[model samples]
Target: MPTILCQLEAVLRFLSNDPGDPNMQACRDGLRQAIAALKRHIQAGSSR
Candidate 1:
């Protein structure tokens, strides 16, 4: 199964075209933040 990080990455890539809608833009921004946070968590966990 794909990890949450992978799934979120896919979603972000799908939205890379910039749909020109304010709502979609905000959603994309949120996704980017989520992805970043998830990545940091994963990295921190892996160091243990």
Candidate 2:
């Protein structure tokens, strides 16, 4: 699986060039999920 930062970077690049594109929203949503998952993973690790 790709890292959250990589996913976010891809999404950012897509949006930067085509902010109004419909696929841009999809990419953004994917990035959001990736970031949320990464955060959860970090929090879980820190609590241990």
Candidate 3:
């Protein structure tokens, strides 16, 4: 199964190699939103 953390890492690696890419910031923001959503889920689970 694909995880947000894994995808974020891949995005970071790709961006680092191609910093001039036009879609960089948007891609990064989307991945960050995914990660944030996952974090919210984790926090909720732990609070239970």
Write down the lDDT of every candidate, Cα atoms only.
0.85, 0.73, 0.72
Query: Which 10 consecutive residues of model 3 have the lowest summed lDDT?
Result: 1-10
Off by over 4 Å in 1: none
Per-model TM-score versus the true fold = 0.81, 0.63, 0.59
Question: What's model 1's lDDT at 21?
Answer: 79
Q: Which pairs, if any, clash in model 3?
A: none
lDDT of 3 by residue, 1-48 (tens): 247667777776676676666687777677677777877787888899
| lDDT digits (tens) for residues 1-48 of candidate 2 | 347667676666667686687886887778777777887788888899
Off by over 4 Å in 3: 1-17
Q: Give a tens-digit lDDT track for model 1, residues 1-48.
A: 238778888899898777887888999999999988888888888899
Better candidate number, 1 or 2, judged by TM-score: 1
Candidate 2 worst ten-residue window by lDDT = 1-10
Ranking by lDDT: 1, 2, 3
Question: Which candidate should be chosen as best, given lDDT against the real structure?
Answer: 1
